[model samples]
Target: MTNAHDHRADLTASFEPMRHFMILQSESDVRVLIRRLLLSCLLIALIAQLVQSQDSEINEIQVGDYVRFELRGNTYQGPVIQATTNGRLLIVDVSVDDRKSRRQVKREACVRLTPAEMNSVFKPVPPASKSEPIELTMPTLAEPGEGEEIALTNEQLPSVDVSSPTVLDWSGFQAGKRRINKVPFDADPDLPYVLDISTGTVVYSVASDHSTDIFVSTDRPSDYRLVRIKNHTVRIADTLPQHGVALGLIRDETDHDKGLCVITGLSTGQPRVASAWSLPKQKVRPLYCHYRRLLPDGSVVCVYENTLRVFDGRDGRLCWHCPVPAFFEPAVSQGGRWLAIAANGRLFVVEASTGRCAGSIPNLGKETMQPCFSPDGKMLAVYGENRMVITRINDGRVVLDHQANVDLAPFGGESLWTAPAVLVTPGGYLMDLRKNMLVWKYQLPADVNEWMGAPESGWIPIINDDWLSFVRIPHQDVTQLSAAVDQNALVAIQAGDSLRIEVEIKDDVRGDVDAFKANLTKALESSGYRQDISAEALLKAEVVRAAERTDHYINFGTGKTESITYRPFGARVTVVHRGEELWSANQAGNLNYHIAGGLQRAAKQLEQPPANLFQTMQLPRRFLSKKFQNGLGKSSVSIDGVK
Candidate 1:
């Protein structure tokens, strides 16, 4: 494989669309980079040898003098007279691309002397032993093959469902934001979806279509595997913006108490660890690596086995670290200010900045499900065996309580003995700290229990056995929705009733599908079209419009756009001028909707035909007439035998 030295010796271009160069590398792009580096190193060594042979040894061997030498059966020659201080042979060449000849690129050759050459012309260089192994440090974001850097005892950890020993088929399941898969062996407990920011690849493994091992199942073997669809159609993993940054956990071989450090992904192409400036030097300190959370604040909260470390939002830096409870699962507030830890069926609300317990909820029976923080960061919901409890995060007071649904079945009947997968859907329950009473519950998906059980923050429970139709609750795209794509557009479509408009929008955001929908809707509105709107005051409104078939009649009347009826592949928008059918074009019956570029194209074609510049309008008999025989003003209005 080519090394970094070879590539650095001759890297005149950027690494965009790097896949095309993969053939040059032995394995992946990294190997190609290595090969390049090695080649450059060899050239430098060769140049140095030549320079020494010329120094104080001969005239005419001056700077700018070119020499050719045969060493170990390989010929080495390039124009280079000046010897670099570091013992490199320098040459210059220009790039050439033509029908006849090609040349010219500034080239440097570093020469190392062979034993024969040294004996005959200069001092002999010593040879090193071949048996000694050379250690190579390849930079990466996540720890490869190593166990978790942060260690915690079982007692200080949250009950995590890492799946089980049985290899289950989870292919085709849409991994919500983050999917956690446990290892069957104790070696590596967790394997989550990893995003490679540099390449824009959502690196993950599916149970190999034929494998029974979880590790084997979730492997990424393809270079351009589909990550997620943009606006429900176009695959977007390979796009520049949607690519994930790589991360790796590396232990500080020098210090042990500091624990482990996390490295972020890079696009350098040459394998290298993240630069220290990429993250904060302080937060980057070592700690028992437990679990890492992508917080709403854009910073990651990495819970150590014993300590809690907070880093900067952009770079991984030490924001703060505090000694805290062990064996606890950490939950962050939506506002990112407070963290809740569950231990011994009790809840401890800790200030995220200081890791000090601000409040505690005690006397919980049986093991407690992790506590949930409300969007406003005031209330927290804790699920117990028989009753689900809600408490104020600021104070240790019970705000609301309800008997847990005892009839709830276990997830896939995997382990009925574990705690019930209970979760409080957003907008589901109302809890007020001042008044301790359950107020209201929103209508959740009726079959939510059938899906992936209960919910956690930023992740929704999804269960769909059917391949064709799937339902997602807490409709994802609303967060980035705007007025341009919101309900205002719905009113415009009704008001204008214009004909023939089409557009293609592009989105390259790295996030959930909902975010894409919101952006697309906005783009549509920005292009002067109204979006369907039915709700008010939502971050993004879920716009649902019936997709009309090729031949269809749309009735937007009675102050509403009522319905659309499909015709037999012949319906077209006709313009009436001077009591004649000026022009009409048939809609393509193909299921795939082809959005034409603009109204100007259609308008230009329609305006040049049939030549009736003014006067009356001809309406379709079916639109204005009661029947075929009973028609309107124009004689051509009759449908039967009209052709």
Candidate 2:
């Protein structure tokens, strides 16, 4: 063999011996080394695993757990009850806050109070259970990071149910004439006071003896005062301003314009122009570059002619500003972001702060006037000669274009004080944006000189174009009631513990679902309700079993797809078939069905009642009962031939 071939074979042979040695190690040196390496690795792995396990321990209190936290160096314990958006927690302890005696301390920090940290005054204590009582011991306050566990146990509390009593209408109260002054006031649900701007004083219609002023505002620095005017003398009553005076026009409970009521003075050289103030704080400041629009965060949009501005109401500050075309009269939405204005004959919607053209409604030749925003600020109603346009603010889509003789000239720099024409033209329209319906028309009334000359204490136009008018739109409540309509024809109505649920099955299966859904929807609604849906009334109606039905029966738990078969009756139809068949066969069902039938006959409760009878009553349950009885009379089908 050649030397190269010999060397190759020898190298291969050497590698074979090394491979064999690696595969099978002898006990003395190699085996000992392998065992030592594996043992070291396993030990390291075990330590790592144990470390992870210890680190995974949860120390924070979970939801629904009773826990406590240290507040003002005192440890208070209660069920980690409920949390509010403001970070206040509701505990089980109930006590009244002693504003007079309690040493008050204000903290600027926003810290979530644990159930234990919250005051006990507002907590609802549950009634004590008669069952076995468990003892829960809580540890005293400990320093942060100190490893200590606090234990809390559920305990019996007082059983008290609080509710709002039926309110007596103010119309029923005796009327007495008293002169009052107008002053700056905030809109309060409790102490609602209306101000007449001309007098610069407040009118407190509600007597202090009749009702206590419960509302308090933190925005104003000084305590609010309740001033009374009697016999030409003004005196401050026992009431004091809970907060300082934040001057601005507030939305009134009634007898006020719905549009933004900003009282601005000649501050920025604009004649009869005043700066808009924030709602709660009422701090006066120039609009972000003097612009007017509402921001998305519920702040007002400020514009000064060409300059755009956005201000934060919580604290008066310019959030953002820019410049854009100044041709149109400015309007901002509630959010203060989207702004709509009419330039020349067309409409333009733009970003309030950036001054960028978001959208536009074009192709009009006449100069537009009197642009009114829908409640949501999503649409604008533009008035013109011979035609009125409703334009979408965001996309520039013309939602509605109604042609009519709407005078648009009166609002174009026509002085409300000088021209009677200003009263009839170019003012504004009241619109319900949610329903996309026009509710009222407003403009400065015509015959200004004649009407102003008329002898009167105040030139109160019983109806004026310049003044806003609110008219009810037909069936507006249907929009809200449609939301609560039962998918299955059944709804539960309850009174105390008594419940009546009526389910209806439509004879016309194809049209039944839709027709019944619609009829039930209308039945649930009533006229004069501001909003469409009343969740409380709907829930109450469900409990009383007085729910009107357009279909066969009120459904319980049965779904459309679910099938329940009666034992004796083998046929499978809707779930109602099973209930009917089962009742026909069972003795208990037969007895109950007959009893109900006899009651219906004895009382003649099913007799049809006049529609006008339902005007005074809210639910019209009696009317519904009569209608249901008429329906039942037409059909002979019953659970056990009880009819």
TM-score of each: 0.29, 0.27
On residues 508-584, what C-alpha lDDT tens digit does candidate 2 reach at each position?
11122333333334433441222123232221111111212121222244423322221110111111111221011
lDDT of 1 at 128: 16
**For candidate 1, what is the total of clashing residue pairs?**
76
Off by over 4 Å in 1: 1-201, 205-261, 265-272, 275-290, 294-327, 343-346, 356-368, 394-397, 405-643
For model 1, what is the C-alpha lDDT against the true structure?
0.30
Q: Considering every candidate listed, which one attains the maximal lDDT?
A: 1
Each prediction's Cα lDDT score?
0.30, 0.27
lDDT string, candidate 1, 373-430, tens digits:
5544555665544344566544456655443222111211111111112233232332
